[model samples]
Target: MSQTNDYPLSAVPQSARKGFWSTAFVLLGFTFFTSTMWAGGTLGTSFSFGELLWIILIGNLLLGSYAAGLAYVAYKTGLNSVLLGRYCFGEQGSKLADFVLGFTQIGWYAWGTATIAIILVKLLELPEAYTTPLMIVFGFGFCITAFIGYQALALLSKISVPAMLAFIGISIYQGSIDIGGLAQLSNISPTDSMPFAAAITMVFGTFVSGGTQATNWSRFAKSGRIAVVTTLLAFFIGNGLMVFVGAFGAMIYQQADIVDVLVAQGFILIAVLMLFANIWTTQDNTIYNFAAAGCNLLRTDKRRTITVVGAAIGTVLAVFGMYNMLIPFLILLGTFIPPIGAIIMADFWFKHRSNPPSLDKIKLPAFDACGLSAYAVGSAAAYFSPWIAPLVGIVVSASVYALLLYIRSAQPVAKPSAS
Candidate 1:
C-alpha cells in the first residue's frame, strides 16, 4: 500500500494523467456547492426568471472561461496554481499567493463546517449544545477524503455527483408540480431590486475563488483539450445548475438553499441527505484546496499532514462562528482574489509564452517585481471600481502586467565590463 501525496511540490507526471470522465466528475463535485445556490437565491429575489437565467449563464461563462484558461496552462505544465505561482510570482513572491489562496479556502471550509452543523441542529431539533461538537466532528470528518488524496476525491465525486443531481432533479420536479410549472414561475415577480451589474458581480464572485484554484485537479487531465472542456463543463454547466436550483427555490418558496427548499416541500429525509452530500462534496474539495496551497506555502510533500492541520484550523474558525462572516468574506474574495489568477494568466501567456520551464530545473528570483506590482495595482483597481470589480481586477491586472513588461523590454541594456 502506498501513500499518495499528489505531487504537491512538483509537476504531475504524464503517466498519472486522468481521462475525461474522471477529471469531469472531480471538477463537477468541486463546483456543485451550496454557497453557489445561496448566491442564486439572492439573484432570484431581484429579477425575473428569464433575467436570472441570462445572469447565471453569462456569469458562469465568464467563470468557466477563466477556469479553462488556467486549466490549459495546468495541463501543459502539469502544475497546480500554487505551483504555477512559483513561475509567475517568483520563489518568495509566490508565498503571497499561497497565503491568500489558502486563507480563502480555509474560510470556505470553516463556513461549510459551521453551516452544516448549524443547519442540522435546527432541522433535526437537536439541542443547541450539539452545534459546536458537530462542527468539530464535521470539520475534521470532511477532510478525510482530501487526506486520502486525488483518488478518494474522484471516488467520492463519482458517487456523490450523480446522487446530488438526482436529488436536485427530484426537488425541481416537486417544486414544479407544487407551483404549477413554468407559466406560474414566470408570473412570480421579484420582491426586490438590484442593479444588473451588481447581479453579475454577485454571480461571478460566487465561485471565482474556487475556479481560480481548480488547477489542483485540472493538472491531472490527460490533455489540454480535456482540461479545458472538462473545466468548462464543470464550472459552466454544473455550477449553472446549482445556481438555477437555488434561484428556482427562492422564486417558489423564498428559500435559497436546496436543502431548505426540500424541507419546505416536506422532503425532510431528502433534505438531510442532500445537505450532507452537497456540503460534503464541496467541503472535501475546499479543504483539498487548502491542503494543496498549504503544501506549496510550506514547500512540503506532506499533503496528508497539511490536510489534517488545515481541517484543525478550519474547525477552530467554525467553532468561533465563521458562518456569520460569509458576506464580508465573499466581498473580500471577489475584490482581491481574481487579480491573483489574472496575474498568473498574464505571466503564463505573456511572460512564458505558455511554456514555462520546469520548476526544479531553473533557479527563480525571490520576487518578480512585475507580478507583485501588477497584483497590487489590480487589487486596488478592483477595490475602487464602481463597476464589476472582479472583471475590473482581471482586466487591469493583465493590462498593467503587459504594460510593465513593455517598459522593461524597452529599457536600454548596459554593456558588460571587460573581465
Candidate 2:
C-alpha cells in the first residue's frame, strides 16, 4: 500500500511542511559553523591549499549524496529519520535509534553551549566561575528558540546567516591581504605532509553524521527535488566553505575558527558576533532534533515540554564538562549512522520500488533481527577498517540486509494482522 505524503506524524504534520528556500536556509544554517573551520586547520597545515579544496569538495559531495538518499525518503513520507527506521528495524526497535540519535544531539547542544561560555571567558579575561553562569544563560536562551520550533529557527537563521557570512568575508579579506594575496597563500609549503587518503577521510568524517541527519530538517521539504538540491547545496557550498575557512585560518594565522583569529587580530567585536552566530545556528537545530527524537521515543506530542527538559539536561551536562569529553566518542559513533540510511535506502528502493509503505497498512515486527544484526556488523567494519568507513559500512549492511530479505521473500508470505 502506498503512503500518503501528508499523513500526520507526531512532530511533523501536513501544515508544517516547508518550502524550498526555507528548508534550504535551515540546512545551510545547520552546516555553517566554526568548528568545521577548525577541522580545516588540520588539513591546511598538512596539505596544499589546492589539494585541501579538492578533498573538501569531493568529500562533501559524497556525504551529500549519501544524505540526499535519506532526505528523499523523508520528503516522500513526511517522516523524520527515526520514524522511518520503524519500517526497517521494527516499531519497538526504532526506539533504540531514537535514543541514540536524540542523545547525540543533546551532547552536541551541550558542547556548543559550553563552548560559547568558554569563548566569552577568554574574550573578557574573566574567571572560570563566569563560565558556569554564562553556560546557564545561553543554554536556556537557545533552548527557548528551539522550543518555539521551526519558526524560531528560521527567523534566527535569517539574521545569523547573513551576519556570519559578512563577518567571515571580512576575515577572509584581511587574512588574504596579511598573507600577501591568493598567489602567495597558495604557494606556501605545507608544514606537515598528511597522507592524501587520510585527509579525504578526515574531511568526510568531519560531519558525516550531519550529512546523514539531513532528513531531520529536510523532512519539511515541499518535494524530494527541493530536498536533494538544497541538501547538496548545504553540503557542497555551505560545508565546503567551513573547511576552506578553517584551512585558510590555519595556513595564515595558525587558527581554525575564523572568529578566534579575528579576536587575535583585534577584531573583537566581529569575533563576538561571528562566534555567537556560528554556534547558535548549530545548537538550535541540535536541541530541536532532540525534541523531535524525544517525541518519537516517548510517543508524545509535548515537543515544547520535552525541549525544556532536554535543554536542562544538556545544560547540566555542559556544566560538568561531560559533553565535551564525549567529542571523540561522538565522532567515532558517527560512522554507524550512515549505515542506517543505507539500510533504509535499500528497504525502500529494492523491496517496495515505488512509494513508501503506509506505516498503518504494513505489518512489521517488533524487532527486525536481520536489520539490527547488520547494523552491528557494519559499525564494526567502520570502526576497524582504515578506508572509507562510511562507504564500507553502507555496502556491507545493505548487502547483508538484501540477502536476508531475499531469503525471507522466498518463504510463505504471512498475512498482516487485522487488529
Candidate 3:
C-alpha cells in the first residue's frame, strides 16, 4: 500500500476502519511503556503502597478519559490531532501543534532508544563499547514495524502485550515471594514524601504526549464507542500496569525499573526479553507518531520517508545522551502538550458540534486566533499552576477556547461598515 493509504493527508474512509481487538492491541502496546515504569518508581519512593495504588488509579483514569475524549473526535472525523488542529488552529497555525507534539514524541523515541541500549549493556555485562553500536542498531530497527504502518503495529502488539504481561506477572509473583508476600509489601514504608499534586502530574505527564497523538490510530476505529473503549483500555489499564509494576518493584526490591528488579531477582534472560518487547512496542508507536506529525508539518504524504528521517533524528539524539534528560523532557511535555488536545476537543464539541467538516470539503483559514490564544494561555497557566499542571492545562485551555467561541458568536456583525 502507498503511504497515502495510511492517509497522512486525509481522513480515513469507512472501509479502512479496524476492529476492536486490532485497535485495542495497537494502543495497548503503545501504553506499555518503560518510562511510565520509571515515573511509577519515582512515585513508589514517595508514597506508601496504598497511596501509590490510589494515585495510579486516579491518574490513569484522568489520562484515559482525556485520551478517550480525543478518540471520539478522531473516530467521528477520521482525523488525527494535527488534522484536527487545522480546524481550530487554522492551516498555518496548526504547524505549531505539529512541531510541539512531534518534538515531544521524538524526544521520547530518543530516550527509549538510549534506554534499551544502556540497559542491555548493564544487564548482560557487555563491554561499555557496545552501547553506541547497540543504540544505532535498535534505534532504526525498532521503527521497522512502524514504517510498515498500522497493520504491522497491531500484529506486533497482539503478540507482545500478552508476553509482556506474562513476564510482569512472573516478576510480580517472584517479588511477592522474596518480600514475604503482599502483607509485608504493603507495610513497607516510603523513603520520601511528595505532594499528591506533583505525583499526579508525573503520572499524567509521563504519557500525555503519546495520548495526544494516539489519534493517529484511533482515527481508524470502527466507531466512536470502540475508540473510547480502546483508548481507555490502553491508557487506563495498560498504563496502570506499567505504573504498578514499577511501584511494586520499588517497594519490594528497592528497584524502580522492572528490568533492574528482574535482574535483581535472578531473571536475567527474562529481563532481556522483557526489555526488547517493552521498548520495541513503544518505540514503533513513538516513531510513527513523529511521522504523522511530520507529514502534516511538511504537507506531504511521504510517511515512510518521514519515518526513516525521524528514526535517524531520534537515533542521533539517543547517541548523544537523550536518556539523561528524561525527567525534564517529561515535565515539559506535561506542561505544554495537554493544551493541544484541550483546544482540539473544544473545537470539536463547540465549533464543530462533534461533527467536523471534511478536510477536502472546506478551505481553512491561515490562522485561528482562538486556538493559538487559548493554547498560549493554557500552557502559561499550566506552567505556573501549583496544582496538577496537565489537568490544569486541559481545563483552562478548553474553557478559554469555549469562552472565545461564545464571545465570537455573541458579537454583532458590523454589516460591512454600513456600506
Q: How far is candidate 3 from the true structure (C-alpha RMSD, Å)?
A: 1.2
Tens-place lDDT digits, model 1, residues 1-419: 13388888888998899999999999999888888898889889999988988999888898888889889989999998999988768899999999999999999999999999999999999999999999999999999999998999999999999999999989999999999986788898899998887777777777888989999999999999999999999989998998899899999999999999999989999899899989998999999999899988998888899999999999999999798887577678888989888888888899888888898888999998988999999999999988888889999999999899889889999999999
lDDT of candidate 3 over 267-291, digit per residue (tens): 9888888899999999999999999
- Model 1 misplacement above 4 A: 1-3
**Pairs with backbone N, CA or C atoms under 3 Å apart (clashes), candidate 1:** none
**TM-score for each candidate, following the candidate numbering:** 0.97, 0.92, 0.98
Number of clashes recorded per candidate: 0, 1, 0
lDDT of 3 at 172: 89
Q: After the best TM-score superposition of candidate 1, give how far the Cα of residue 191 lies from its true spot, in angstroms.
A: 1.3
| Clash list (residue pairs), candidate 2 | 37-246
lDDT of 2 by residue, 148-255 (tens): 777778788888888888988899888878888877877978998866656666666666667766677788887779988888888878888998998988988898
- Scored by CA lDDT, what does every candidate get? 0.90, 0.79, 0.92
| lDDT at 120, model 1 | 100
